[model samples]
Target: MRWSIEVFFKEAKSLLGLGKSQARDFASQIASISITVLQYNVLGTVKRFKSYETIGGLFHEATDGAVQLSVTDRIWGILQELVMIIAEAFQIDDERVMDTLINRSETFKHFINLDKLELKQAA
Candidate 1:
């Protein structure tokens, strides 16, 4: 029990900066401590659900999962797959199909942010 308390204090200070607030006023310091405790509770809850062995490990894993592809990347992937399917169906070169689509469809270009130069490179 004592060891667990020590671990909590150590991790709370090291990971959450529990006492690092430079606020000179008593109320501000209390608020800062409250925020730190809240952060610790949130992380603890996540750790409980995720079964992470240590606070540091959970912190790193949580941060690593934050990265995601943007809207443009998803749209570009869908467009590439569609172009490939059309090329396969028509027995035409992918580049040729892509050129035709880019040249003729003003709406497609406007929606997808693709140009002939980019289409050439992508194909």
Candidate 2:
């Protein structure tokens, strides 16, 4: 399903307590990661459903009740692996990119919100 950028920013800003500029920055980072993930998903470097569902489920499960550092850290680790694979495929600096992307809490918030929305809409 196609996600609307405006909706992403709106939900992310609210959930992550991010300002518009920060939300935009986070959104950009997510877009880049998503593109890389999609590439990997298509190329069979990553299992489309397995990777996407795991990452997506992590966010939902993490946010369903309380938001904790441990949960967030675990989710971060999963994303880090995904990012590393993408970076390796394209010969880029995985650590630097992953570090930057993981800190964007707004991006994660949007991811969860969008995934929830997609699922609900599908149902």
Candidate 3:
């Protein structure tokens, strides 16, 4: 996931023709937001579980069964909006940035689907 995000950032930077420092700054911000969203999703899931067993049981349930699903989705939306804002700030192409964001999001979604499939098979 980290690698995918890094790749997305690099691709976006290259497409935008940003300098190394500016690209690094933008990537850093994106990474920070991603980490925040991940942490929120994890913590939110933990909070939703009444006990360890319930938390463990999450893996056996559907991907969308987690209480943090909606929150994570919202976070992703916010991240995309932020990327658009950054593109505007840098005078880069919004469509290019949006495309990169969408690609990265699709990659993440694929992983989520794979996890759900694995969980279903296990159960």
Clashes of each: 0, 0, 0
Measured by TM-score, the strongest candidate is 1
Return the lDDT, model 1, position 28.
Answer: 99
lDDT of 2: 0.60
Please give the lDDT score for candidate 3: 0.61
Model with the higher lDDT, candidate 1 or 2: 1
TM-score of 1: 0.48
Please give the RMSD of candidate 3 to the true structure: 23.7
Q: In angstroms, how far off is 94's CA in candidate 3?
A: 2.2
What's each prediction's TM-score?
Answer: 0.48, 0.25, 0.28
- Which 10 consecutive positions of candidate 2 have the poorest summed lDDT? 39-48
List lDDT for all candidates, in order.
0.84, 0.60, 0.61
Give RMSD to native, each candidate.
Answer: 9.3, 21.0, 23.7
Over the stretch 1-123, how does candidate 3's per-residue lDDT look in tens digits?
Answer: 999567545543443222333335767767655654554446346746746543224433534565665876899788788988999999999889877765789786686789899999999
